[model samples]
Target: MLYINQQKSALQASTLADLAEQLALPTQGVALVLNRQLLPRALWAQTPLSTEQDHHIEIFQLVAGG
Candidate 1:
């Protein structure tokens, strides 16, 4: 349940969805990597995040241009 939100280091999270919901982001563009292994975004909903797990999240934002 330890998650790094953007700039900050580590924080406690109840669940991965909770973190995504807090950020108002869909699980699609966000990538989860635990202990240096990349986790597929498709598994976000099913992935069980715990306090014992060390996770790194990468969120991607899309920009529109003319």
Candidate 2:
């Protein structure tokens, strides 16, 4: 099982892109971090999730404020 935003998740995904899709994340104004590293949007499709290891995925929403 993997952790999403510090919460336990049973959802299984082959790639980062798949995970994002499963979560219905916005295309913009959001950032994804995997294993303490910032994952670029372009790499999401190529990044694979390993079942052998537990992963930690963090999603940060971009906000605009004064």
Candidate 3:
């Protein structure tokens, strides 16, 4: 079980990258955080997310407008 932005989700993954893919979210122009910690893009593929673990994950997207 995982709580993304305080919303309950049942998705499990071995890495942050995998979790993003499973959620079908755009990897570009976005950022991921775990437990109030900033997650780097380069580390996403190695960062861990497990079914047995409960975490507070947040994704922030950058929007550009002029």
Predicted model with the maximum lDDT: 2
Determine which window of 10 residues in candidate 3 has minimal summed lDDT.
46-55
Better of 1 and 2 by TM-score: 2
Candidate 3 similarity to native, TM-score: 0.82
> lDDT scores for all predictions?
0.59, 0.96, 0.85
lDDT of prediction 1: 0.59
- Flag clash pairs in model 1: 1-50, 1-51
Candidate 3: C-alpha RMSD to true structure equals 1.8
**Candidate 3 deviant stretches above 4 angstroms:** 64-66
lDDT of 3 by residue, 14-51 (tens): 88889889988886888899988998888889888866
Q: Write the per-residue lDDT of candidate 1 for residues 1-66, one digit (tens) a residue.
A: 354644554545565566667667763545656545665656556666676646666555544668
Worst 10 residues of 2 by lDDT: 57-66
Q: Candidate 1 or 3, higher lDDT?
A: 3
Worst 10 residues of 1 by lDDT: 1-10
What stretches of model 1 exceed 4 Å from their correct place? Answer: 1-6, 9-11, 26-41, 62-66
Q: Clashes in candidate 3: how many?
A: 0
- RMSD vs true structure, all candidates: 4.0, 1.0, 1.8
